[model samples]
Target: MTLVLSACSYRYGRVRPYVLRAFSYELPDGLTILLGPNGAGKSTLLKLAAAVVVPQAGRVSYGNLSSRSKEFRREIAWMPQSITPLPSLTAREYVAYVGWLKGLSRTDAWERAQQALRRVELTEQEGVRTTQLSGGQIRRVGVAAALVHDARVLLLDEPTAGMDPRQRRLFRDVLAKLVEDGVQVLLSTHDVADLAEEADHVTVMDRGRVLLSGDTGAFLVEAPEGTAPGRVAEGAYTALLERGEQV
Candidate 1:
């Protein structure tokens, strides 16, 4: 299914609010990187697409289905930038709980939860209380919860935030596998290095508005004339920051 946003805009409230202006894009079953500076509304846009937030104007639709519809809700899985777990729940229990909420049978929920824990390399930590885990470990548990249902659309906000180099690589590999399986992924990140050779599409946003959106390869190739070839990814990201400042 194609997730399309057409002229969608969002505002927090009437006062001290900035507009996430009308922007349109179609996301297919592959990795699309959402890149932007701090407070650029990357998170807001992801939330809007995931139906966690309503748009003030225009619409976001998945194929022919509106984002607010129950069908759309069932098809999308969202992982926020920072996840705080319930201190009392064990990692395994949390995953199982989310699985059940996603409509899995009790037996099936446990089975899927176990598989997800293994996939995120947290199987050994499953019995540990969420409060006992480190930040990165907790994030892994969050990822596992998102995967337990095998939803078609995955929206992740800074999935690699608290991960170390090894963990980051593991997460990337898992994401690659998901994309290969035809899962549509929309990921927001400040790490430009993570985007190279992974993202098929790129959308750059600044101050709650999209500045540029297109094929990743083309964006890298068309960067400013003085940008170093070997450092295309870094240079392009630097350019984006400069552009953000201009706005």
Candidate 2:
């Protein structure tokens, strides 16, 4: 099921002049990465798709179904930029609680929670309380929470914002495995290093609007202008913003 956004718009401040412009995309399967710097409207796009906020105009849909339906909540899972796992609960318990909240039976919740943790490579940390885990592990726990119910589309916002290089690699490996297993992963991040290698498609945004979206294959090519290939996205993003694309 492709997640489609049709002429969608949103804004933070109540003032009409402050609203972000409308944007749309029919997101594909596999790992689609949304890249942008801070306040570039990346998280806002994810939030709109997750139905956490209704847009001031247009609509978000999964295939032909509207995002406002109960079916929408049942089919899509969202892990926001800031996640607070229950401090008192173990990693497995937190995931299971999320599963139950998503309408699973207690027995199914426990079972799926175990499976979800395995997907994020947190199986060994199942018994450890969330408070005891490292930042990366906690982030994986949040991803596991989103994975518990087998949601078709997973929306993650800036999940690797503060991870160490090693932790970031580990997390990206987990995501690759999920893509191999056919889960559609849509994530937002300010950094594009991982997207250079891991993403199937890349969508770039700034100041509440999409700047570009295309196959990651093109983005992975050696960039011109004597820049490092790894820094192509970084360079392009800066250029786009400098051009006043969103102003």
Candidate 3:
């Protein structure tokens, strides 16, 4: 299954400039990393894929399913940049609630919530109220919510922003496992050094347009000779943007 965007255009307000203008992309299976600086329209693209916002022109679709279709919505899960705590809900409760919203039965949602929490290594904190958990723990809950419904497509925006090194590694492990299970993941992040190696495909966007996109191996090959191993992806991304600027 793949998510596709075609000639999509969007903006926050009628008078404001467009965040995405005639943007288009087709998601590849496995994990794809979306790299961009802040305000690059990365989040906007994910939101369109997630069906959280409708484009003023063009469309987002999953195969033949339209973005407006309930069936299409059920096939994907989205985790936004910010994970807000539900005032009084425990970690598990919040996840279960999300599953319920996704069309799972209450009983099934509650049971799957446990499994989701476990996948994120948050089983011990399942009963902890969201208000009492630390920021990283709360972000894990957001991920669990997205996983609870067993959706085939996962749209995650800046998922590792608040995570510590260990937590981030654990999150990467979870994503790798999901990909092995045939889940398609499109994750947006600014930390290219941390996730470039994890991607099967890498797409870089700037100023509401795609700068470059291709297989990870091909992208890494763009780095100049003698670039440090640790910064290869970052180097390639920088070189692409710099080249664009010169045009």
Candidate 4:
């Protein structure tokens, strides 16, 4: 499956259009990290892919489905940066609800909910109220919900934000597993230190345009030696931020 974005741009009232231009790249069935600094339109691009916000111009397509299609919604799992669960539901119940929304039968939804919790390492805490979980734990629950339907495309915005080092490692393992299973992943993160070994491709965006999009190995080779990978990534991120300001 591939997501194609052609000449997409978004505009809000009064201000000049955020000029996200014509760009097309195929997302293979592996991890693709979207890297950029704040306000570079990384989130905007993800939202465009998710079909949450309509593009003012151009089109986005996924396989045979357009961005507005129900089939497109079924094929993609989007985990936003901040997810607030229903106050009264337990983690397990919440995941089951998401599964149901994805069109799973009651029995299948419950079973998948259990498996999703296990996948996120939240099985032991399945019965805990969503409101009772810590920030990291809540994020795990959100991940579980995202995975419950087994969507082919997973779009995660900072999936490891509140996680500790160990949890981050665990999440990386989970992402690797998804890649192995042929799930296409598009993740946005500031955690460059943790990504070097796992991400297959990196797309660096600056001011609503891609500055770099290539294999991770090429990026490492191009980056200065003796510089921490995180620093290199940060420099690229900073450059994007500056570019956004220029626009």
Instruction: Give each model a TM-score.
Output: 0.88, 0.92, 0.95, 0.87
Candidate topping lDDT:
3
TM value for model 1: 0.88
Per the 3 Å backbone cut-off, how many clashing residue pairs does candidate 2 have? 0
Q: What is the Å distance of residue 101 in model 1 from its true position?
A: 2.7
Q: Where in model 4 is the C-alpha error above 4 Å?
A: 14-16, 225-247
Worst 10 residues of 1 by lDDT: 16-25
Query: Candidate 2, residue 136: CA error in Å?
Result: 0.5
Clashing pairs in 1: none
lDDT of 3 by residue, 160-233 (tens): 99788887888888889888988898999977776897689999888888888888998898889999978899
Cα displacement (Å) at residue 67, model 4:
1.4
Candidate 3 Cα misplacement greater than 4 A, ranges: none
Candidate 2: Cα lDDT at 243: 58
Q: Per-model C-alpha lDDT, please?
A: 0.82, 0.83, 0.90, 0.79
Count of backbone clashes, every candidate in sequence? 0, 0, 0, 0
Candidate 2: tens digits of C-alpha lDDT, residues 97-174: 999988999999999999999999999999999999998999999999998999878899989878899999999999
Candidate 1's C-alpha runs over 4 A off are 225-230, 240-247
Candidate 2 residue pairs in backbone clash: none
TM-score of 2: 0.92
